[model samples]
Target: MECRFPSVPGAERILSDEALAFVAALHSRFGERRRALLAERDRRQARFDAGERPDFPTDHPGLSDPEWRIASVPDDLKDRRVEITGPAERKMMINAFNSGARVFMADIEDALSPTAENIIRAQINLYDAARRTISYRDPATGKDYALGDKIAVLKVRPRGWHLDEAHLVIDGERVAGAFVDFGLHAFHNAQALIDAGSGPYFYLPKLQHHEEARLWADVFAFTEEWLGLAPGTIKATVLIETLPGAFHAEAILYELRQNIVGLNCGRWDYIFSYIKTHRKDPGAVLPDRAAVTMTVPFMRAYALHVIKVCHRRGAHAIGGMAAQIPVKGDPAANEEAFAKVRADKEREAGDGHDGTWVAHPALVPVAKEVFDRLMPAPNQVDRQREDVVVTQADLLTPCDGPKTMAGVRMNVNVGIGYLAAWLSGRGAVPLHNLMEDAATAEISRTQLWQWRATGTRLDSGETVDAALIDAAFHAEVEALREALGEEAFAVGHYGAAADLMRELVQADELADFLTSVAYERHFAD
Candidate 1:
């Protein structure tokens, strides 16, 4: 096994011959299956676009089986009340581990820009973090950073099935990003993590069907046997982020029963999925992103159903990201943000969620306070949520809020801003006081496409058409340029980002994901 990929800093240390061999083995064994699954997704999506509505199957086999249960939740993963999520960047890696949260989700999927250096270096960070040797020193300030006595339990989130690792090729074919991430981390650190009182864990993303979950289960099984580990040593939490995935939550859990421990209400991606899945439905138009809070009817139904399904199968029901970063100097604004975070977590806790996620460390205490007060036990998996029932109507109900012109401007502004930041190798960006990532970007751009496709009407009595949307896009870009000034805008990939955002929003057809195109053309090495 000779490797031919481009190198990164400390690449040899992370990508040893044995590790590369392990990754290659996984690629060879599962690569074809992954390609088939992705193609299946396109086929299903095409059927959906041609007016086939998605609904729960009436002949859902064995749904009434009362005896099947998922594997037991490991101790380190049992209390995930405050899981802080971010990319596995070096400084962020050290900070997140010591952030005092119960669990830290080192995300390589939506929260990370999949640059070559980023993909390889992230594995190195996780390897070092697992060995308790993670540290970083700011070269400019000479500030030393190291892990603290108190640290969060680490869980890795691999890229979704839709993505591929262009930097890693095995047998003259590019490997799936999920395989590279999972194979490397599991190969290098699974046993060491188990030795240190934890186990290899993952949060699966963007699963559109139970078959995809089944694919992941098989991968876990194969990896464990190949690595000489126990069959169920690896546990996974599936993100019910798509409409089809939400409807098939029970089936998905069943497919991965032996290696499943939890289900997350991946709220942002769910919104994006709603738009993509229902783009052709004239009545499926969503309101402004601001108005589409978790309290909306569709969102509420999805959240409750996920909790119900997870608890029914003896697994944790984790809530989605709060995405609130505390304000520094403004006391009133900070108080309002804290109040919102507290309320969201309280709702999740009261509704039978075992744990929840926060994006920033500052909001950790707020989230922890809510869950701690509500959950005195390790988890609330015992709460079966028998009273909550979600019908297909409930999940598809549109909000009553109006889609306004201001909403159009906001989407273009934030969408372009996030794209610039993403193209510059930053995935998690703070814009207009909100922490945004690929999920938000996905929603921003997809919503624009959806509105245009459906001829959505704004509150100002204007229908969404190409001319109106195009003008909004250009106006927003010029405003952003002025706001960022010549120097700051010129320093990054803002020019390319503006063009890409405009092309995506103004095109006749919607792209599956903006990053899929952006990564291939701009970031992939």
Candidate 2:
């Protein structure tokens, strides 16, 4: 198999001939299947646009079987009380590894800016992280950083199936992004992790069907065999981040049952999925992003449903992300932020979730404190949520509240601000005291587009239309420019972001992924 990619700094060490072989092999076996599944996603979207609401999935064979369970996870994975997540950048990885959380999810998907450089950096950084040799020294401060004696368990999240890796072209085409992320790490570091008593653990993202789970299962099976590892050596937790995914929660677990360890409530993307899935429907227009809390009826149902399905299948039910960051110098605001985090973690722990995710390391102890008090056990997998009975209506219910000018402005500013940073090679940016990633960025842009498409009337009685979108868009651009200052704003990717934002909000149809558009327009180098 032939491979072509830019020779970045760590290219030689990370993408050795053997590793390239593994990548090519996986792509050869599963590349066509990946495209087919993505197409299926489009077909499903068309069905929804044609007025068919998402229904509860009950077609899989294992949904009715009560005795079956997911395969047992390795020892280190058992007690994921709190997990800290960030991009696989050096210092961030070290901090997350030493955050005292039970697990650290080094995210190469939503949490990473997948420029060719960042992609190569992540692979090298993760390889070093797996071997416990990653370190960094700040050029400005000269402060050296390394892993702690007692580090968190390592997990990696690859990009979704819908993405393609432009940097690495195989057979005259871009390989599936997920394959490169999962393959390079697994090829170079899987054995090392296993030799150190931990397997190649992963968090699968953006799955919308059980068959996608099945494809991943096959990939896992093949990797284990090719690497001469035992069956079930590769354990994964699927993120129920899509509306269709929440509907088929049980079936998805069953598809990957032999090698799967759990399911996660990816709340941010799930919200985006809800809007995207129902983009053409006026009735599903959501209100302010702040108004859509986890306790809302539909989100609550989805979270509880994930817990129920995972626990019943004897798998861990990981909770959603606490994206709040501690604001410096504003004690009152910080207290309010911590209070929100406390309440959110309490809800998850009290609801029988085994663990949860926190964005910043400061919030790690905050979340761990909640879970430590609520869940004494390492995991709550044994606690079957029997009373969790979710229906189509409960799962499909959108939040009812005000869609205000405030909401529109927020959507526009965040859309441009986050995208500007993202195009400059930063995936996770703290805006307004909260960590913003691709998932949250998706929410920002999609909400604007959805509101615009639906002509959603705000509580202020202004109907969302072309004029309103333009007003909000231009205002947010200028506001971001002023707020960020002249020099900073000039170098920012605001122009490109605004261009994409305009395309998205004014399009006759909603775009699927905001990152995809930005990836093409800005990452053409």
Candidate 3:
């Protein structure tokens, strides 16, 4: 018997092809199994999409009473240094802690290998050591006494994404308050932490988008309900270390406002993110390995972005960690490096950042010293009216038409130079063949006010009010126009000038720009 098939040219051609023939043969051999496999994949994907937490086991116990609570540190200890280690690593922790740091985070996440048994043993040792009064003989006096709270913070590794071996074991046990890292995804081990009665608080890492922040909020909300914790108790500190996060910092903070305690600049991950994000661009030729120094532009941008975002949201803007420090053997190099760190801290404090972080215990005293030196006394700059100031000079200078781009270039150069000088605490520095401290106290007020309007945090650790911010905007616009009088007219650059005016009108943009400039100035050296 002969069978007749459809006469469609395209379909017939496909069937005649060798590749199709082989595919058909394979399907005939295992089509049922393939269909079942596809269905299973879809089922798993659907579960994932439906917000089902994956069944990953954790050794950490569920919270007996889950509640949202803010962790507090002593005021004097706020500026102190911290060390990271456990009892097994006690010597290292003691060495670092005694050097100068105010706190110690017994690190089991990045520093230790992912061995379930080992991790459990370390946690037990850490818990036991922290609960008891530790004594160390003072090398100088050869005397033994209880080490004054040898550790301030205890950090635990709660089985990260790739760490599926169940390294974290809780066994229904509770230790005095300790901080845990929820590594990468919030929904992954969140329920476990809550179930074990571990607080809803966590250190969130590698946050890339505002949606991710929102996702964290949602997960916290779910975990709170599931574990019966208070609504706002699930505090989080986002690790802003990606290019997307850098750009959308304001959005992220705005979305996760109440739940976040602060934002931190993760230098190493940020460098890696910068490389990964921009590697495709031929013009951006970056070095093979990111140097530990802060000279890179993107690095500065990331740092400043964190400050701007945190300050805007009334949260702490903790600076990046000064990871490298000179050891005791090299006093001169140590002092120089320490001095540089202090200078950087001073600049951050001056820019109105809340605080900064350092990895080494020895660097803490220097960090605190710099922070203390730079921050202005509370309420030094007062609220003022925008219309009170009058100036004939135009704050905005327009770039000339395409035909005379050179004139536009000159205008840009002059404007930037003036702005730079004004920012450098040298607004009165001589330039253009003239010497004058042209920047007045009013100008200083205007600059600071402009920065404050951006929702930048004040030294008092509060977000600036919108009304005062608006007043500052107008004042800066007037002052900038006065500063650029004839130069604004020379290039016929009214449009550019107007845009600048508009930017100064908005506090957020102004704050971001000012902070970026500050970072560049401090670390660009």
Candidate 4:
């Protein structure tokens, strides 16, 4: 109903009267319930703080029907052997669609820093992308870019329900960011995609509970009704990335059964959630971020169980990300990165995952090669993992490894670097040859907080306290300054990022998400 900054040019096209009306209708209908669900998160968190552990819903009716299955998926969505994810920036969009993957998920969430300009720009690109009219040229290099005849299927990821778009005010309240991203695109591009023999496809991120999934289902149903489309026109794959959300996989699939197609194992955020959900439990302190691989007891259990539950319910069980980016001009380093990605993708393929994600375009073929060689079919949904049985305790199994000073240094360095880039208008950034997004940075921040709060003892007998944290931060900052010259470091947002990181890691309680605090403090319209 209102714009926070009306003077921002190009706002008119995205915020046209009809678009605003649709978004406002969505907000007016579901805004209060969205707020209630968010409050439910705090309530559930309070229980976790009070020593109540999360468990699967025992009374869910959907589990009673062993024959129940989600509606059949679209033909294009089947055979998603390799999927690529990136922010909806112009160049990234063009490249990702042409990345030779089955699906290119244009993420407007963690992979994107939610600036007003960025959100509007993403929506505009999605409009063009749906119609295959998207194009670009290198202003500096004089090179041209356009969509090829064959491109990866476009699936958009809107911001999670926990976020709001400060730039778009509707009915005197800041509209949900999810509504803006989903509403604008679905409003503008759904019919075009339908006409093209495709429909509005989406990847829902950061759902901590099945109720959240239920809310999304309601949103999708309402959108279809609003747009005069058939039921189940919108298809989504939920990312079972949170510790709590993983426990409710059956219920989540049940809630979105009408429009649901698959479930993805999100590694980074699930680890982060494991730390945050158990932040108050001293025994749950994890090891170095790198040490906690998908093979860990809990992660392994969840990954296998996802395959079991998804296949049982006739949905595709997508695997986690291969975040390793290819390095140029250094054959050895590039080989090492390639090896890591290959191993990860192979494990996913062998474990009966339908597909896996790659952060960069170059790694698409690398992932595809693994799936293509091993799978030899469109999908393996028939491989019911009945032999794989994971229990409540198994899903919550504690990680085991050594906590060291090196781990602390890496966390501090990566956290600051990511925050600096996120504040500088980039959501997905390259750090140490890997693509770092909000989810990865979350692992850094939450791990640091858990260590400090529990006074974790490092390999060198050093206790994780405020002093040790400050020391690590300072050491990493100086190292970064030398690595990236003083002039560049001084001009960047590293200073503000440092100040914010200190406040976050030093807080008495762990924050839910670093982006939440950062967006409100700095990037808010």
Q: Write the per-residue lDDT of candidate 4 for residues 1-525, one digit (tens) a residue.
A: 667644444566777889889999999999999999999999999999899999989888667778889998999999999999999988889999998999999999999988878888888889889999988898999888999889999999999999988987865789999998999999999999999989999999889888899999999999999999999999999999999999899999999999999999999999999999999888888899989999899899999989999999999999999888889899999999999999999999999999999999999989999999999999999998899989999988798898999899989988999999999889999998999899888999999998999889998999999999999898888888888898888777887888899889999978888999999998784
Off by over 4 Å in 4: 5-10
Tens-place lDDT digits, model 2, residues 1-525: 444456878779987888988998999999999999999999999999999988876666878777898888889999999999999999999999999999999999998998888888899999898889999999999999999899999999999999988777776878888999999999999999987778899999999999999999999999999999899899899999999999888899999998888999999999999999988899888889989999889999999999999988889999999999999999999999999999999999999999999999999989999999999989888898898898899999787877789988888888888888898899999999999899888998888888888878899888999998998888888887787887888788787778787888798878899888778877744
TM-score of each: 0.98, 0.98, 0.46, 0.98
lDDT of 3 at 212: 56
Predicted candidate 3 versus true structure: per-residue lDDT over 107-163, tens digit per residue:
443333223233333443343333443335667888654444333443332322212
Judged by lDDT against the true structure, how good is candidate 1? 0.88
lDDT of each: 0.88, 0.90, 0.41, 0.91
> What's the CA RMSD for each of the models?
1.3, 1.1, 23.3, 1.1
How many clashing pairs per prediction, in order? Answer: 0, 0, 26, 0
Residue 327 accuracy (lDDT) in model 3? 46
Candidate with top lDDT is: 4
Error of 2 at 127 (Å): 1.1
Query: Which residue runs of candidate 2 sit more than 4 Å off their true CA positions?
Result: 1-4
Name the better of 2 and 3 by lDDT: 2
Candidate 2, residue 99: lDDT: 91
Q: Could you give candidate 1's per-residue lDDT for residues 1-525 as a string of tens digits? A: 435455876789888888888888888888899999889888888998898877775555525676788977898888888899999988987888888899989999988988888888899899998899999999999999999998999899999988988877766788888988999999999999999999999989999888898899999999999899999999999999999889899888988999999899999999999989988888788999899999999999999999998988898999989988878899999899889999999999999999999988888889999988999898888888899989998988788797999998888888888888888889999977678899888898988888888888898999999899889987887786887898888887777887898799888788999999999898665
Question: Which ten contiguous residues of candidate 4 have the minimum total lDDT?
Answer: 2-11
Q: What's the TM for model 3?
A: 0.46
Pairs in steric clash, model 1 = none
Candidate 3's displacement at residue 121, Å, is 4.1
